[model samples]
Target: MSEQPPSDCFICRKHRGEISIPGGAIYADDLVYVGHAQIREGQTIAYLGYLMVEPKRHVPDLAALTDEEARALMILVTRLSRALKATENAERVYLFVIGENVHHVHIHVVARYAGAPKEYWGARVDEWPAAPRGGTQEMEAICARLRVYLQKESG
Candidate 1:
């Protein structure tokens, strides 16, 4: 069983269904939740195929994950990366676990498309202005495709 999250924790609130995220949940189990990254307020659209893999438990960082949780997290991250490449036609996927902003153990699974400039590689993949982007409708559609792909993959 997981411990209760503090009221101020964003991931906790998100897991509790208090926070709204775009594309909803692509996949989830007892240990991890996979979903598209959220679109911030006032932003017309967000970079498509950007995803977040987060622990269901309210752990602060990687050091806090149990062995089982760690295993589950990494497996899901790897699978999601595969999903992005297959379903999104991504040339590469960038994994980032910077906990500076949210303090939660969330991994950013960013997709890098083919023909992308070297300047937009790594942590700057989302900064590519010409990258595929979408609002809620496109996000929902993309997530649906991903959900179906992952479901079939798991089967």
Candidate 2:
């Protein structure tokens, strides 16, 4: 993979600019940012708490991650998963290591709602239909909520 600037990669740019979706980012250190993913215009995936834990550096694969990136990833996933279940009211938090469409290393942490289908569990979780998405104001609110929770945990 060619070198991608923080602004060029989907996850990387999110580390620097306006969050494109609701519940976008909760935390960021020198290595990564815990944020949300972008959706196709017509397609929606999982429920809220659909977060993306992304490395601030434009890393292309998991095997390429530094020791710090790997360690932070472990910490973020464990903490963020709990944060989703507790604060976002998710029964389960689904995680996906997405490097297919984009080359960067990003983790998808999706919240499973009250009646999420078993068929859509595991790898197929991304196929679920997410409706009633919030607009910018709502999105910002969600981000703020997660940010607070993450901050508390980090502190």
Candidate 3:
């Protein structure tokens, strides 16, 4: 198969500050902050590092990932999963890399609970735990809590 040509990838663009960081999330050198969609308690999205971890790289297919990229992605996945589970009090954690829409490599580290609906199981889930629709005030509060949780965990 022919190798894909290099283009200005979206992730790369965001990483280099060419694009504004997406709202509802924070950007760290090691991770991308994806804000909670459902605004549930202890639910958040922590995008793995840019080395092709959870989300496969450049190409949409998983086969495109190099051995090293795949390994790194797995490591990041495990780390994020454990962190979400502990900090969010999640009964289970879900890792997703389906890029049918956005082809960039990114993972959805969802914090799951006991009563989670069956539809969200496995690879078809995206909704956060039950929570009222929150605005900026709510988002900030959740982000702050997550920051604290992550800090404590790292320490």
Off by over 4 Å in 3: 1-8, 22-59, 127-155
- Candidate 1: C-alpha RMSD to true structure equals 3.1
- What overall lDDT goes with each candidate model? 0.87, 0.72, 0.50
User: Which sequence of candidate numbers ranks them by lDDT, best first?
Assistant: 1, 2, 3
Who is ahead in lDDT, 1 or 3?
1
lDDT of 1 by residue, 42-115 (tens): 88898998998999988888999999999998898888888888889999999899987777789999999998
Which pairs in model 1 have colliding backbones?
A: none
Which scores better on lDDT, 1 or 2? Answer: 1
Clashes of each: 0, 1, 1
Provide the TM-score for each candidate, comma-separated.
Answer: 0.92, 0.81, 0.59
* Stretch of 10 with least lDDT, candidate 2: 130-139
Best by TM-score: 1
lDDT (Cα, tens digit) per residue for candidate 3, span 37-138: 332347343221111233323555557767776666666556556655665556777766776655655666665656658876665444434522344455
Q: Name the lDDT value of residue 56 in candidate 1.
A: 92
Off by over 4 Å in 2: 1-7, 18-24, 43-46, 129-132
Checking candidate 2 for backbone clashes, the offending pairs are: 24-36
lDDT of 3: 0.50
